[model samples]
Target: MAGVYFYDNQWFEECPKLIGPTDHSFWLGSSVFDGARTFQGLAPDLGLHVARLFKSARSMGLAPKETETEVERLCVEGIRKLPKTTELYIRPMFFARGGFVVPEPESTEFCLSVYDAPLPEFDGIKIRFSAWRRPAQDMALTNAKAGALYPNSSRALREALELGFDNAVVKDANGNIAELATANLWMVKDNVASTPALTGTFLAGVTRYRVACLLRENGIAVEETTLTESDLCNADEI
Candidate 1:
């Protein structure tokens, strides 16, 4: 994995060891991050991804030292350091270094990593419905792209993979369809595309929003509404 990382006001070819045992983020999981992809010299919705990173930091109770524009600029600069034709995953992260049970907002630190990660070929994936469910808004930090929240998703994904499926379709607390364990969910039925409506249970991914817009612009009807397992079983495409 060829990559470049920017941390502590310097760029590094190797990922620097930035966290330790006592670090708030390492122990308490006070971290937030966002991923954006660049391929063939085009990065769609990079700005939106950067903006969401800051929002996630705030939601996680960490303060970001850099503005969204500055982070986005750093991302582009990092991309330029790599081959233009390489497909890359751009990740910007914020973590807290201080506080015991609660993270100190002033102890936030930031890092940016850009790495070669080719997009997966579209050889359709097998998905199974998972027993795991997303937490209600009050039960967890559902609004932020926080690392603490991923363990549940990891468990769901692991369960699916163990059952010979590529991914799992997770549900919200009410047992309504929420999303795939790793990404937003979408289905097509009767020539209309639909996704689970934003219900504060899952992150409304940047790519998902972009896809919805593109579909609508191309004369397809896209709907955001509550979805059920029955809908998934009957969908023409997913």
Candidate 2:
């Protein structure tokens, strides 16, 4: 887990400053985080991830001090300090400082935690249909990758784990399958790949986009359509 953090150009490899108890992010959940990955000395899509981090913060009304270039530079520098053979998760986060209901955007704090973590193999995953569902866009800022939105997924995951499953397939307010507890869901039939359309219920991941493109280029049709629990389970493959 050897990596580093930066606070105003200063690097801290250990014992960095932590969020306070009353911080808006800690108390009111005014925070957003985005992740990128490093493997074999290459940081793929770091720019897009950083850009999305800032976008997520802005969507939640928080101001990020660092630019995408700056964040990417810091990530590259941090990855250098870690073991080259080990995979790493590069997470850049932003949080608000003070407010009652709405956060003070100017009080946003930033941290980039690049830590060594192994990349899981893409063998397969076990999923169960979870009882917990996602909120409607009117009920929450579901479009952004906000911290407060994650606890619901965590609960769904806990329930699935208790049932001896690896992950849970979450539903939306309308009883449509939203996604798995951790990622977007895809099903296959007759060599065609289909996934649930973006409905402001989950983050649109970068890998999903690239994979869809690659599939299309290779002549495997990919469709973004509404999906239900029944549709997924009844599919030829998932």
Best model number under TM-score: 1
**lDDT, candidates in the order shown:** 0.95, 0.85
Candidate 1 stretches greater than 4 Å from native: none
Which of the numbered candidates is closest to the native, going by highest lDDT? 1
Query: What is the number of backbone collisions in each predicted candidate, taken in the order shown?
Result: 0, 0
Q: What is candidate 2's TM-score against the reference?
A: 0.94
lDDT of 2 by residue, 134-224 (tens): 8988888887788899999999999999989999999999899888899888899777899988888777887778778889999999999
